[model samples]
Target: MAAPTSEPGTFAVTYRWGLPLDEAAIAAVSELTCHLLKGCSPGSSCGCKVNRNLTRLVRQGVEMEMPDPTLIYSEGRTGLPMADMWLAMVNPYRLTSPSRVYSPDFRRPRVQQWP
Candidate 1:
């Protein structure tokens, strides 16, 4: 959990994986998480504040994952239920889709040096 920012009552959740996950996979997961929290169907074309604010936030920093503001109060929608549901069955390893068997960018082994 991150410290509250200049935005009133706003905070961020940060994650650092030991293995650097693929950027595309991370993005898919992030968007799915956002939509789930906003009570919006995945891939829905809703012009809701949740989507708009999230897009802006992600654009600002792709390295950081941004929570859907609408789930809190940005869109006047309380997402407590959705949040609870998520927490009850959260799986960090869950993927939106199967990853490639091998990719130079995501699957390359890291070089290590012995002390």
Candidate 2:
């Protein structure tokens, strides 16, 4: 799912992983989504810095096969620290405007849940 944005060059991308995910999987994918929001440019090759760095980070940081959905829930939460180590990595493009990362209500589809 994606939220509407008025910016011409910006976009919103949401990954709806059905519930039952452990905290670690949620964290990994959330981090991945944040990298995507930081601007994976169109026509980017596999060598795109965003792609390369995020992949490496996931591999080293998580060290697990990306898990499949394991449980179901009405609501959950996820945190993305835009000002933390994520920003320490190289992002050649600008941050996607109006970017937000959170756990959505799987039962309600695109409805976002608050902390």
Candidate with top lDDT is: 1
Each prediction's whole-model lDDT (CA): 0.53, 0.45
Tens digits of lDDT, candidate 2, 1-115: 2434766666767787867866555666677676665557677553325222122234445763421222111112122344333433433343545567666654555878999
Off by over 4 Å in 2: 1-19, 40-115
Cα lDDT tens digits for candidate 1, 1-115 = 3555666688766788777656554655576577655656656554453345442334444556545665555433334454434433443454556566766687666999999
TM-score, per-candidate, Cα-based: 0.21, 0.22
Q: What is the Å distance of residue 82 in model 1 from its true position?
A: 21
